[model samples]
Target: MNDRLGRLRDTTINLAHGSGGRAMRELIEDVFVMAFDNPALAALEDQAVFPLADLVRHGDRLAFTTDSYVVDPLFFPGGDIGTLAVSGTVNDLAMSGAKPLFLSCGMVIEEGLAVDILRRVAASMQRVAIEAGVSIVTGDTKVVERGCADKLFVNTAGVGVVPAGVSISARRAQAGDVVIVNGFLGDHGTAILVARQQLALQSDIESDCAPLASLVAAMLDTREDIHCMRDATRGGVATVLNEFALSSGVAIRIHEAALPIREEVKGACEILGLDPLYLANEGKLVAVVPAHAAERVLAAMHAHPAGRHAGVIGEVVAQPAGIVVLHTGFGGQRIVDMLVGEQLPRIC
Candidate 1:
């Protein structure tokens, strides 16, 4: 049986692996379990049990988040769905000023998928988990008819500890609060777009998919009173700003020239007739802080690798509540509204 499992390691997935029989057990034991080995995971049980003492030591609140990845092409220049799955959930927890602790991965795969490819993705997920100081403590696998599902899809749910006395929320933005972004926008969306090769365009752009817990920690260390934190994912910074504005009942004003965008990303957006502000990002974050703490938080962000391109792009305003306006480079102002239609789909 062990020899059979060993031989199957390098093979492609078949319908039998999802049949809830010996083949299924062997597949789980060989692939997911081995790749994401941990104390709770090694138990090979249906649920992951954590020590209450451990949870209480770091925080008084629990942060939980779940996200699903159905990105096309599976792999992009800088990251794949594997990294995105882990980073996406981690970033969600981080946005609440939490210390991400664990993740549960659920995979929906099409029959006839390559075992090697699944192994590679599992390995990538493991690597990213280690880098982000989290663990995949539990998971499930389901194989569907080949044509009914995409080649692969991943869903991740994560839990983290939010330190006592710390509060972060989109609704916390206040007038005079400064808005800061950790890095370039549109990189992830553009990278995925180029991967599609629909426009016959090419660029050196790559996805900025990464974990933001460390950067968040750095900022919180300096000042836990930072007003709000959000990962600019599906809707990009503009959309996030709109959300914050509506939630907090405050307007957001951003300076176009002050926004940090990579040249390659800018050129790609120009070519695609897309606005960078409306594009998606994976590793970037939007932080709002009181004017007094803005400089300190910005400094802390600059000190972190993930935030090297951090910039103060805007501020919260009192008038015209629930709106986001951008100061254009040409000395004109325009409303940056939530995208009415999908500018780019399945990019995340």
Candidate 2:
């Protein structure tokens, strides 16, 4: 592994930086390779190689997923695009009750982007990858004209091993199951809105962007019988509940009173005429577990830092299958449908 960070002569990215030549090599070696130092990455091979036996020890099946991130503002209060890229991919693999292991990062950089900014982003990715217990084994990079692309865009693909006897899926939700969430919702969305618009709102809402594999591991340790698990990302909890309902052919009813939302996020949503339920949450997850295991799982979630504000928001029902209903605090009920349009674009 490259123990020393590589230094670049250029202050900003240029077309030459993306060219498959000396500049590109320096960028890869000095920035990405140094930050994500590992044997597989440091080898500088065309592809990352791993021992099949290493994977077999974890499980018989492999879970793979990929996602792209292009948040309007690369940097946010709690995290940057680099952090979001790694955490998002890791969380996707963890939703399947898999132990995340490896990731591949791809970046599309715009010409004139500050070299320092790219380095900062790379450092963020490495920090989050370490926290998620994953290695960045391979990656690709490209540079586009200044106006052709945003300042930067990141794509991350991840692979993990699903342990034996663990089968968690959205379609596994069943009637009489309970829904639980890890931590507050809508903070990511609210934070982006505030940052993008430069809103002078007095709020402490920072993007709840985090890697949730550890929290998921804690939950599985407490109860491997978890039925459904999904990180509430772009579409938030409302979208995840609807997916569970549709996939399992069951009804999911959540109580507004039971939701765990921060006062700052709630107030921001109200001021912006937004529904916190549909706001994005990078760090939160909606889990459906057997009713009997709900309390134990919630207790386990509470024990983890990521799930400190975990709560049992609702449960599944037999009637009105393929839909999600929300019991309002105002002594009324409403159907929480999927988001009609993009509420906040470029939000991870």
lDDT of each: 0.90, 0.91
- Please, what is the TM-score per model? 0.97, 0.97
For model 2, the run of ten residues with the poorest summed lDDT? 1-10
- Residues 209-313, model 1: lDDT tens digits: 999999999999995488889999998998989999999999999999999998988888888799998888999999999988988888998999998889899
Score candidate 1 by lDDT: 0.90
lDDT digits (tens) for residues 1-348 of candidate 2: 444445678889999989988888889988888899999998888799889799989888999999999998999889999999999999999999999999999999999999999999999999999999999999988999989998999999999999888999889998889999987889999889888875659666788899999999999898449999999898889999999999999999999999988888888887878899999999989999999998899888899999889989999998799989999999899999988888888897
Model 1: weakest 10-residue lDDT segment is 1-10
